[model samples]
Target: MSKQADSSICAYAYCSHEQTGYEKHFFITPASLLQHVQKLDELGYFLEDITCMQVKEGFLLTYHFNRWEKPGRLALRVLVVEEDKTIDSISSIYPGALWHERECYDFFGIVFKNHPSLIPLLLPPEMEERPLLKSSEKLRDLYELLPGCEQVLHAPRDEEFGQFIKECSQKGK
Candidate 1:
């Protein structure tokens, strides 16, 4: 895992393709998402999927991409707080995202701002409750499920993740 390659995308740390099956994984802000995604489109990556997960911190939206020639996956992750369940729509860049985004909306109640026809895809229109949301007690921090600053089969403590992030940030200086 390494720091972000450029400023356009905010990267803390990412797992290697050999280790995680992703060529690169980046943690970015919703503000910078479209610009970076446009770069990926220009680089010939096709949208594979967009998945949403509820965590202790908030909602984690991961967008997966890959190129036919390269044959490796890449991910751009953004954290949206439970308070503001919104982010810009990438359907303009990748038309296929319409379905994935809709599924996220149907299942998680995530509002994809500027998404054209942001309606239920799998669930019925009258279903007011999101099926995937867990109770607060069941929600786990992202570190428990994902690699924080590095990969480990076991979940790392929050302090470990915080220290790792700090150490990695110092390296950039």
Candidate 2:
């Protein structure tokens, strides 16, 4: 696990020799999202796709980047709080992200800050409700959804997750 000077940007132990998928998955704070994506761009990672999932914690935005020459993919996951469904745009670093971001916005209602234009990509302008938002009762734990897979909270540090877990534990009291 590696981290940048900014504690918000952290790389976890998602990668392993036996793993056949992405090389790494980094948890990034909303503030460091742009910088992290920019660094990946500088390292020659091409934007492959951007996927959003409505999780119990919030909205999980995963930016998939790959290098053609090296042939590996790295995903940067950013958790946007439900109340603040926004994150910095990586369109400046990877122009292709523009469309992907727009699509995410259209479906997840996640605003891409400073995006050239954040109009809906797949939905009509008249649409107001984001169809992707799931009800709390239907929301499932990450582990339950993906059996046998490791689950890592998208917090900057494990301690932060610990705090959140503690708070959640006390909520029923």
Candidate 3:
């Protein structure tokens, strides 16, 4: 793989080029999420949708972006620690992200900071608990649900993924 591809793959714990048939996925930190999205926007990538997954460590947020002209998709994954449960909103960069982020918030209880209006998109506004929050015991590991994610899951954080990839690359050398 090219260095760029290797870096992208190593950035995320559960990234897979095969998962969504996307070209690549970069696991990013919550702090860098906006910067990534902004860069993609400048590259003319449109926001497709944002999906959230509840995990043992926290909620995994995936922002799917694609370019119509080039026809390539990229998934940017960010893990928000459970206690914090928040991340910067990309709605400013991609206006479409607003609705998707709201929906994610409605179902996963993730707060998108600076979102113009982060209200419930699908459920009743009064609902207290997010319907999609699952217990860790009931939640299956990413590898179990997505084949090819086994290696990815072993390093659940972005930093760990980077270190794992670095070690693997050095060994191959």
Candidate 4:
């Protein structure tokens, strides 16, 4: 589906530490989650949203970004099976994704490749099981914008950190 029609795609203020141009609207998708990260590495877009999703089949890995050198917001996503919840680490590209990946692993049981250290960032040492997979209530609020959604600022943001299952539901299966 086109991002404009997809409720999972939303427009927001793209803020980043890098010195970029004016913020631009961006689309979010489970399919493009991973591709966008790879694109950012190649295109020099600053990291925007680095989070994962819970899908019926499994999980969706993503990294959102705003282009500092260009003019656009980028969102990347990748779907992973429950049995093999893993993906390549983007630390090589963004350097900062290292901690983000670790946080994903700590809470959602995602495995990152070639990470210098993928230790727990927000979970206790005794918490062995994946917290996000444990319950549906701990999901992030999923959202997408309709075309011409100039009133994007009114949407309520999901602040809960343990909303893994909610992220996956945006798949619209």
RMSD (Cα, Å) of model 1: 8.8
Model 1: per-residue Cα lDDT over 41-124, one tens digit each: 766789999999999888989999877874667777778888999999999999999999999999999999889899889999
Deviation of model 3 at 157, angstroms: 9.7
| Candidate 2 all-Cα RMSD | 11.2
| RMSD to true structure for each model, in Å | 8.8, 11.2, 7.1, 12.1
Highest TM-score against the true fold, candidate: 1
The positional error of residue 47 in candidate 1, measured at the CA in angstroms, is 0.4
Clashes of 2: 0
TM values, all candidates:
0.77, 0.75, 0.74, 0.57
- The C-alpha local distance difference test score for the whole of candidate 4 amounts to 0.54
- For model 3, residues 1-173, the per-residue Cα lDDT tens digits are 13333333333333344433666576667776786667667666788889999876677788887778766566877778889998999888888888999999899888889999999888998998988889767986654554455554444445643554365356542
Candidate 4 lDDT over 95-163, as tens digits, reads 888888888898788888788888888888778988667455554333321233333323312221113
In candidate 3, what residue range of length 10 has the lowest lDDT sum? Answer: 1-10
Q: Rate the local accuracy (lDDT) of all candidates.
A: 0.74, 0.71, 0.71, 0.54
Clashing pairs in 1: none
Cα lDDT, model 3, residue 55: 70
Model 4 vs. true fold: TM: 0.57
What lDDT tens digits, residue by residue, belong to model 2 across residues 1-173? 22233333224533542343655565656776776666566566788899999877788888888777766567777778889988888888888989999999998899988999999989999999898889899997654653333345534543433343355346531
Error of 2 at 123 (Å): 0.8
